[model samples]
Target: MRLRHIAYALLMATALAGCNDTIDGAIDVSKVKNKVEQPLPGRIVAEMQKKNMPRNSPIMIRVFKEEGKMEIWKAKADNRFDKIADYDICAWSGKLGPKVKEGDRQAPEGFYNLTPAHLNPNSKYYLAINTGFPNRYDAVNGRSGSNLMIHGACSSSGCYSMTDAQILEIYAFARDAFRGGQSSVQLQAFPFRMTAENMARHRNSENFEFWKMLKAGYDNFEVTKRPPEVNVCEKKYVFNQQAQGSGQFSAAAACPPMSTPPALTAALASYEKEYQVAYAKAMDKLDGKLWYEPTEAERKAIVAEKRKGRDLAYAPTGTSLAAGKLVEPEEFEKLMAARLAKQTAKPGQILTASTQASAAKQGRVVLPGTAPGNRSTMSVQTAMAAPAPGAAAPTASQTARPQPDMAQATTTGSVPVPAPNPLAYAAVQQPTETEGKKPFWKFW
Candidate 1:
């Protein structure tokens, strides 16, 4: 009887395993049906054919907020991902930062993933893929938020929005990957491009430490062109193993002994070595000083030089009454009176007629007007020969005055205009925390 019972137990165990396999097969079949029905499957297949990649290959996504770009990377037969496309993010809320809480209306920045359940074909925004926010790392740190997504409709509250056409293609990529047997797709979102220059520029930001931690993961894929195995330990993200043992990982507990593949280890080491060399050179070029900061004297000199260039470019150049040389007070008053009289001269009267008449009355040599063209020439000669109302004799230098600089009249300080914030859109309705009633079909 005991032997019979053991046989029954073994048979039951085998049956259960078969049932599990059957269930998984059904799920995959359903996914394949959904994917095939959409136009995306054909396009994906064509892309794979063009690249000499097999169908249902793995894929990944990377988002750069400051650049407003999302890149799709597809795994080739060699197991390394190749960039397939870049889509413009149509709209995203908030500035360059991570989403921390509900109602903050901030798009998240960090590593996240999507599963089959996260796909929403019936979404109001046309389609969406939920970003698994508040993952193990977020939970350990007590962060909270939900339903963050990359969706369509070109509008956003706290989501990355792409046009309907773009989302159609993006959604198809993820769907085909899932249908191809991928369990989950990884998505890495960043505030900006992770580079040595960007790191140095934002070194003093409050989020610098967190960003540095993220760069480890960024560099992993950057070097290997493969998605990094992600794990959270002690409330921090740890990527690509550093020690050897079972591959088990825990979110809140101390990380277990882990080891990286020898080839990956060597590659990462070489990448870091090159990065350090470049970083050092960049720092040395800056003399270890912040690029944005300048001494007061240096700033003033810069402004002065800019002002001088502007004046030279824009200042008007011409002969004018104000260009006359400095003279005795009585002589200056007489010149001003002559200019005023010439300006107010009656119609049909020559511009210098009043000045010439006054000069002739003072017993000055007044030349006769020749032809119309020569009239101006005669007037100029007559004025040059005339003396001030009550001044002494003239000197040779007094007759030839240097043109005055019109720098003050032309120089204008440029007012720096602040750029408009891209996130300043009409406020979107905040998502409610209450879970809606589940479909009756789910009860089964």
Candidate 2:
């Protein structure tokens, strides 16, 4: 009887244990299902509706090194950009902050521009997005020849990289930008928030002031909740002026102070001597009013020679001409021809097959990114279906969509709805300032 009672008790205890486990498992599964079934955040969904998010438009890429995040804003047909996607990136190498000088191998800070010329469709990264603008600020301060790229795969010596999955989304925007005639894309890469706390972290470094200015812009944008307008010229960036205007016309814009007249004269003299020889030869091929005073005999000769090429030998007269005199014409022509031969010329008017052949011998310039090394060839995937003309894009209302991974979407912070096809908005926000910063050069 004792043995029977013991066996019975053991069996009851085992059954209870199994029952508890079943109940716990059911509860856990229910909790997970509940979380998954919850509706998408109102902010994100609202933004999607407001921006008509994901319509084809120009793309604005912003990389925040501090946040390890890359944000993509798509331009609408109207030419305004709405926040479309955010990507996680892996720097892989380099230091933990903004790049300032050459040999740093650190990711650059400030703004860059990209065009189709910069695109690398066959890149090892599978997809590459050209930052439409390079840091004009760096080049203006004399840092040129650094290549900045966003590519697929988390492998980089010092570039912004993404996983293969993330790159697909990025490539979609880049392709649209290229086809949409916004062939060039704009990029802004920043170190951190340029926030006070972040700046204080580097309090002992000499780059504090540099950070201060960048921080000001960053803070201004963060607080105002607007991207600070960036205008770039010849690889230089400035905030106060439009990117493509004559800075002299603006009174309020902060421009590089004009150099003294002597400096201007010297520069003009150098340019005139270097360019005038070649220009004179080309212009000599045309009929034009001469800047130099011509004798009646020379003028008559010039008129007669207009149909044929001229070998007119003019001499210096005043001190200005004498002091700035060019070498004799025959000698100068020889030198200029040699220089021209050395240069990779633009498409010149050959006008004849023989001339074309001769010019061709000067050799074609291997445009960067077009070479096999740069991955120029494109991989075109055929679309499975075609849409009718002027058809509306498929939206949530039009189709059943799969839910995104909740874990992946959780990282994105508060996001505002953006206007759909904001292309016009970006086009209208014309840069208010334009000026190239002087390069850092010292006369040897």
The window of 10 residues in a row where model 1 has the poorest summed lDDT is 403-412
True lDDT of residue 367, candidate 1: 25
lDDT tens string, model 2, 320-417?
11122123334433433443344434566323433333433332211112223321111100110111111135222122111100000000112121
Q: What lDDT score belongs to each candidate, Candidate 1 first?
A: 0.56, 0.41
**Model 1 per-residue lDDT tens digits across residues 1-444:** 999999998987685444322322221222233432354434345667788665668889999876578998988887678887787776666545678778876788877766666687778877888877766667677676777789876666678887666777788788777767665678899877777655544442335557767777888788878777677765577776533444345566666666556676677667767766655555445332221211112223433433454423221111111122323334433553454455356767664555554543332112233124322322442332332111134344123211111000110123121232222222322222244532211221
Candidate 2: minimum summed lDDT over ten consecutive residues — where? 403-412
lDDT, residue 6, model 2: 100
The Cα error of candidate 2 at residue 232, in Å, is: 6.1
Estimate the overall C-alpha local distance difference test score of candidate 2.
Answer: 0.41
Model 1 ranges with Cα > 4 A deviation: 1-36, 41-47, 246-248, 284-444
